[model samples]
Target chain A: MSLAGTGPRRDGPARGRPRSEAVERAIVEGVMKLLEDGVPLAELSIERIARTAGVGKAAIYRRWTGKEQLFVDVMRAAEPPDPELPGTSMRDDLVVLLESLRLRGLAGRTSAILHNVRAQMKSSPRLWTAYHDTVIQPRRRVGLDVLRRGRDNGELRADVDLELLNDMVVGPVLVRTVLRPDAELPADLAERVVDTLLQGLRPS
Target chain B: MSLAGTGPRRDGPARGRPRSEAVERAIVEGVMKLLEDGVPLAELSIERIARTAGVGKAAIYRRWTGKEQLFVDVMRAAEPPDPELPGTSMRDDLVVLLESLRLRGLAGRTSAILHNVRAQMKSSPRLWTAYHDTVIQPRRRVGLDVLRRGRDNGELRADVDLELLNDMVVGPVLVRTVLRPDAELPADLAERVVDTLLQGLRPS
Candidate 1:
């Protein structure tokens, strides 16, 4: 159940004229690498990352309150900004959008970060809200945009609730991937999802 | 966060001569009681249940392999047998069908068992599958049957894949209930859900 995170705490602050930006980048990259490789946070020690990153552990702690905070950034690192795409065709747009989710889910780095996010969300509502603001909202807006576009394009009948559609696109895959790791992904799941959604969303 | 059946074990055997059927029934009821109360498993130990059920710990262990197994049974206990209602009308039938789910999710006993069920699904596939067979499949059949009825009745368009409709019906509520434990039941959530599904399931 334990997944890797940024790592353990360091006691001292960085005592130099200036900390190198390269070191900061290396710390994040090193943590991401460890997590992707299935390193458990229990074993993802700061000492291990320092050795890997060639950066002092003390410098890592100087910049962050804890491993969780650093991992929050790690989770937000490469996520797509929006859930939908604006384009000529709604179906084609959604196909690309959902495919992005599929690609991200298939990636070891993204899945690990998502798992960590779920774990953190359980204990920290404040962190959850913050992550929602910094991490989840932009993605939500994209989904909203796609539905709005779909209606305008006549691809979808009007009278559809865009907000509800936005929830549908993200909620299922997110739950299936993050909550049920072993859930089967049909080869045409994205197409089927969009098709089914459009069926409901079509204006009467 | 804790919406489903993660609270206390309910499947273990109760002690006494010939494993009194009456007392075992009482034990199951006791488990449901604790769940409705929002009691965590950590606090709702076997000792408390035994005392509450007036049974011995040996009895509880004899029935279930452990606390987890007990809770699994307690959970499966609440899932209703699939309804055999046969009719062509999807709307009337669905109203009957979804009411069962709402009763379960909104009711104290059922919701508690579900809370524990969700927490454990990711941890143990074996238990989860068993729980599904014992719990979910029964509930699932209700939706599947409704779709069949919808197709037979002129109300639903022909050529609709009932399986997808099945997912459409149950998946969203589950997503809402699990992701946001405090999610308000929108005044029209049920009607909207049925309407939306009908719109999708309708023939082109």
Candidate 2:
């Protein structure tokens, strides 16, 4: 795995300046294109990605250790970047986190590419674990941290289970996105989910 | 689609006793056996299922219209039956509905058969629609009816969106079951979720 801030390592013969950003974009987009066209992940190879990207296998190798690393990069490139928390309040931060989820769900509709790619990824244990570690866990940690802060600051009831709370807060958005694909994701979905949950279902 | 109550049609020459109960069980179990052994749903045919169940093709056709109808029955037979909602209270009824979902998630771990079979079903639009109509929609309708009754009886806030509330109440269970398969489904999960939501997150 490449270090986040250290930049791409220029190890192979292609080492002069850093790799062109255009080349990187092209490779990532090419993988996305193949996935969009219904190419199953199991069928994708470094050779095939290089062919589609119009680059040599060496070029792909220069950037990624292998298919798994490249796939992690592909998912990162595809998702909406992680939310920038406002530090204003827990409620505000949660809305930003959920809004990002809503956008990903909307974005996933393009060729339903993410949905297809994820399904294929889940079929292989190694690939799915890679994705869960790199892409899923960190984002989840962010949500948990926010909830922890909320509980400590007395914004949330101390007795509440943070893990369960995290699920309750995130679950509605996921239900719409993953399970109920036909359901509309209104623009105010994030706010509605947050406020409704905070206010409790019982009338005051 | 065989009508729920109208027993098997006895039009076929071989049918004298409305299809033996033992044979019906065998056919459904046979389909499940194939799925459990990792047979792709797309590859299953009536003849293949008949061969596995040790019944003739005629026996299957006499029972089901075709693959889609048979698949629906398979899903139905596999799922824990819909809860008999306790007419006690809205909260109690919601818990019953969610407990059923919890059981399903646990049941699904066996061979991960439901997860795999559902994934395959979604790939085929026609088949998925049949499933959505027969299995998914009815279950959703039951939840909605319970919510409606709750609102009417003043057990729920009058202004609540029943649809959204349904998703909110059901979402956590689905998250634990479907999204975060690693999460524990504790014995009191349904009660905990309901009470927490009713109490809200805001500190009293």
Residues A96-148, candidate 1: write the lDDT tens digits. Answer: 77777765665533455656645645556766765665555655667677777
Using lDDT, give the best candidate's number: 2
lDDT of 2 by residue, A40-94 (tens): 8888998999999999887787777778778877877777777789988889999
Top of the candidates by TM-score: 2
TM-score of chain B of each: 0.62, 0.88
Instruction: Count steric clashes of candidate 2.
Output: 0
What DockQ does predicted model 2 obtain? Answer: 0.75
Give i-RMS (Å) per prediction.
5.5, 0.8
What clash count goes with each model?
21, 0
Model 1 chain B: worst 10 consecutive residues (lDDT sum): B1-10
TM-score of each: 0.70, 0.88
Writing each residue's lDDT as its tens digit, candidate 1 over B1-204 gives 011344232444334544565666777778777766767655668988887788888767665556666666676565553455435467766765655555555542345466664564545767676666656665577678767766675566676566655655655565555655554445455556677655652234
* Cα shift from native, residue A48, model 2 (Å): 3.9
